[model samples]
Target: MGDDLNNDEGQLPRRDLLKSAGVALLAGAAASAGAAAAQTSASAPAPAPAARSGKAVGARLQGVQHFGLTVQNMDRAFEFYTEVLGGNEVMRDGDFRGEKIHNTLLTDQEIVARERGVNPRTIGVPDLKDGGQRLDVRFVQFDNVVIELLQYRDAQQPMGSGDSWAEPRDHMSPAYPRSMHICFYIRDDVDFNTFIRDLEAESARRGMTQVKANRVITVTSEQERQAAPLDANTNRITEGKSNGWSLIYCKGPEGEQLEFVQALGPVKKTFEDAMAARRRMLAAAGG
Candidate 1:
């Protein structure tokens, strides 16, 4: 969730690029043409209860399965996530699926990147064996959530196209605000306050800049509105209804804009949750 990547304008910071790529990976895995076709063949009829009150819609995204990020050094990133953020190491290896994968875990770059649209072979080098360019990957689990850490060995590689920093003119993309960020949800405002305090304290201890922290409420499109809703007045929702989530925005060590979000409600929960739910419904309906 946190790393030492740069945050700068005009170009997608390496860390943000990695995280975004990771999400893309997860998306792809769930929606690939082959996966969709398989689901269509094995499709089953929905229970009447699940079809009625819509609770079935909410049952899909039960836990934080996994998340991916790119870092500068695998060893340092692995140590920081495990030691600093309190994640447990799960796996380490090389050449996953003959695609030159270096590390494999419940939460790894492959999982993250597949969620988006990027192919791992396009961005991941796997084991330094391919011209000594390997993506340092780590899978860490905290309770039910799985976090994947990815560090591409080559620093000079181009980030990607859909990235905000990499494509500023694409206001249609999420990173257009210059400070593209994501948020995670905590139990309540009390938990929110504690997280801020802890984050600041950690930042100070690490000699990192404590970036400004504030809240902003903005109107979203109908499609966007449906995915992550906000209360009209306070612009905040309950965590359970919204899926225990919140937001943490800060600059990584390399000056890359980063966002850690915790979900709390307005119709659907986290972006991933909502998307997954939609996919499930669509798959069930034979779409």
Candidate 2:
């Protein structure tokens, strides 16, 4: 989640004595690519057409690099993401701690409170004992994005304390402030209902019993009809009147909220047109 360590070095072994050698590699290649794109956009000629069309002018970012989730168990989370969801395991690291890590993670609240002559507990800041806050992380890559699974260990809350929820809570509702959910865009060729049904069955077989897929909701063009429930195994869509989009909500192993969305009919066409316009804009900008 920290950006400061984009190029952290790791040790590699030799073929013979197993001597460790430092190798340079990207810790967050996607973030680095986004930064490069932002730099290029910032250097473009003043008042480009894209900027002129907007009211506010500033640096433009490419898009999201990854989503980070704190999980109760690293191994279980990895299995669900990679085995069940078909994500590729790209990287894994553990025991991330130290002063640099603390500062980068913004967990050095106690140090700041001490310097400012304030009680750390008064501000609800966890005491950073021994500066030994650590995190075990695994990166899983899917077709379009990556999800970073993290298990944190610190003096305030040790590892295996079971802080990550195993069940949903009231505050976790999407209506609550700061609540968020991960949404996956379904492929055009895939049947939305069939995908959800198969996903639920496979996830259960993989030991993610906590993962539950909700009923399919058809968001139609009719203003009076909203969230019409449809069978998860049946297709009940009308192309003209009731084909705006279809979606479903679910929960992951750690009670993380998840969503699957597929745009249909006019909505799909609008999305395609917007994508085409984006390509033309990028071409005109010499990107």
Candidate 3:
């Protein structure tokens, strides 16, 4: 839902940056997944006399319904998303039809960020060439997912992105891959340490160490829950060990790493498919 802030990266609203350091709000990295083997063609009725390898590939995908983020400040991300993550305001665009949808999404982000290695001289930005000037694109919603909050205020802004802890980043680094986070689940009778003491009282009322959270993470494997990708569910776990889901992580005011989830029981079952286990580890690493 945050799709790591719907594909987080940050900036173009200038100065003060930091939206990277692994996970930008993702509760148990959004619920510990175990769900697989459910749809036998929607109810075990139609596929009885099936045609073998002729059709039925897959892509009726229904999960992860929203994600997108580009923030550097749209009024401090609309006051930290409608006052500390309540999030709702499902609309708010800007001029030039938001720069023609921000240059048609920077032409699909210069072709899907060039296979995750990204180019354009390590994002030196320049109106991203022909597309970039939304300056303020909003769209928020929490529960069923949906997030889009860009700023790109006249481009040019990306270089070590401020919030300096010097060098810390860790959702295993490599600059957080899976299109970025948003896992906010927390509802199985709340009170996960009083939600990190109200996220350290909102990072001490925004003296802002990027609003805090980070501690609870417990996977307990099936190849580390199919190691995320193919629209990551971040390996759902919690069927035991006093139940599952449990997670914590926070940071927004630009350091942007969020997640605050809790399940504590019930949610299990997996036959381990996860996109054929990530295509058998990308065909045994021959990729």
TM-score (all chains, Cα) for each model: 0.41, 0.62, 0.28
Q: Candidate 1 vs candidate 2: which has greater lDDT?
A: 2
Ranking by lDDT: 2, 3, 1
TM-score between model 1 and native: 0.41
**2 versus 3: better lDDT goes to:** 2
lDDT of 3 by residue, 1-287 (tens): 11111211220111111111112222222222212223333464333334423434432222465677665556666666655555667777653334555456566655556767766434433253343432446787665566787655443433213222112233432255663566665544434565455544554565555664443343465344334232232234555543565565556666666675554434311212343454454334322
For model 3, the stretches where C-alpha displacement exceeds 4 angstroms are: 1-67, 73-181, 184-191, 209-259, 267-287
lDDT of candidate 1? Answer: 0.45
Which prediction has the highest TM-score against the true structure?
2
Whose lDDT is greatest here?
2
lDDT of 1 at 224: 48
Which regions of candidate 2 fall more than 4 Å away from where they truly are? Answer: 1-60, 107-132, 154-170, 216-242
Root-mean-square deviation of candidate 2 = 13.1
List residue ranges in candidate 1 displaced over 4 A.
1-65, 94-130, 154-174, 177-183, 210-248, 253-257, 260-287
What tens-digit string does per-residue lDDT give for candidate 2 at 220-251?
Answer: 45332223332543334557644667677788
For each candidate in the order shown, give its overall lDDT on alpha carbons. 0.45, 0.57, 0.46
